[model samples]
Target: MSRRRSKILVVSALAVLLLAWEGAVVLTGAQASWPFPSGIIRSGFAITADGTLLVALAGSLQRVITGFLVGALVGIPTGIAMGLLPWVNLAMRPVTESLRSIAPIAWIPLAILWLGVQGNAALFVVAYAAVFPFILNAAQAARAVDRNHLRAARALGAGPGLILRAVVVPSTLPTIFTAARIALAIAWSSIIAAELALGVKIESGGRSVAGLGQLMVATLYVKRDVNALVFGMLVIGLVSFLIDAVLRRLRDTLLPWARR
Candidate 1:
């Protein structure tokens, strides 16, 4: 139905669920172990007041943006080349296919070994997670470009660069943007997973990383703070939702003709 109605329904459902949870905790005397929704909100407010939430969010966003940009820079051009040139596709397909088959999470250990437990390890994982979608979507989009358009451009004496600029780029950009959205989601997940893994592996002498994942891990394991852990999880979900909404808005604004 309407967007407003859908949002109201979602808010109502969440309120019902939270109230039920709060009632259950009150009835069962489990507030010590299981926090109520109010407790979680209070914890969130405490963290925000102390600047913890903002710092963690900044660290996570920084890594995600850097890694995703690097992935896009590398993947989009490679994908476009593969789609445009059969020989390039033939040469790279086997490697790209093999690499993509490995989950980004699976690369955490290798990243740790190569880059250590620092931010670079998380960046590597995020880039790995972000790149494949870009490559796959860009390639598919390029391949799906109307051959007639290319032919028409060529018939008008367009060279390779001219045809690419006039024909291929416009045709492929919508899908590239779609790929960017998918890659961004993946990058967020990858960075969190990478950060969590690194946090767990950190030694007393090793450098401590800061992110929502690390905050959750610390709260859950070190401090035994369930409220903070839940707050961090909620923050992650909210941030992801907001980022996706912004990306969708950008796509709509820039590529109105490509709206699905």
Candidate 2:
């Protein structure tokens, strides 16, 4: 089907679902706690007008970007080393495999213990969530680099640095970008989970973190505002969709040859 047609179908489906949800809530007399689509829309407007949503979004984005960058910076080099060097792979594979088996959410308690309830704790979780995808994908990409290409470059009197710059990097970039897109999604999710955990753990002591997750938690638990909670959930879904769309467009534009 055409893209336009697919989008129309999706929009129609969403509208039907929303209408069903609104009707169910109204008919069941659960509007007070569950809220209808209309109430959530009004909450979105109120939060946007008051700047609450923007502030929470800014904090979440800041942590996600910073932590993802850190993860990519470290993971790419480590992955390259593992791919290029037999000894490095032998030494690190076991450790990486073991660590990556553990979920990022599982690290939240240790992160909080080591870094406290500050933004740094959330950053640690996001970075942890982001790093494994880069390492795994980059290693696969680097190892798949054609030996004939390297040999040809060497025969042409290219040094290790020259061949790496001219051959290795270009060949690896598509996979690196793919890894980046995956890691970023993981990082975004990790930040939200970390922030929500932090908010619950710390807010009881009269301290709070600023994030969409925190906002959701506050609205649901403390303020008992179902509309705001639903609004925050919708904002999270929209932001995630936008981020993925932007990354997919960037990948298609910059690495057109990699497109399937």
lDDT score for residue 251 of model 2: 90
Report, for every candidate in turn, its global Cα lDDT versus the true structure: 0.88, 0.89
- Candidate 1, residues 13-63: lDDT per residue as tens digits? 999998999999979999889988888888889989999778888998999
**Model 2: runs farther than 4 Å from truth?**
1-16
TM-score of each: 0.92, 0.92
Q: In model 2, which residue pairs have backbone atoms overlapping below 3 Å?
A: none
Residue-wise lDDT of candidate 2 within 1-260, one digit each (tens)? Answer: 99999999999999999899999998999978887889888888998999888998999999999999999999998998888778999999999999999999899888989998877889999999999999999899889999899899999999989988999899999999999999998998889999998889766777664887887777777878788887788788888889999999999999999987
User: Which lDDT value does model 2 have at 184?
Assistant: 92
Q: Model 1, poorest ten-residue lDDT window?
A: 200-209
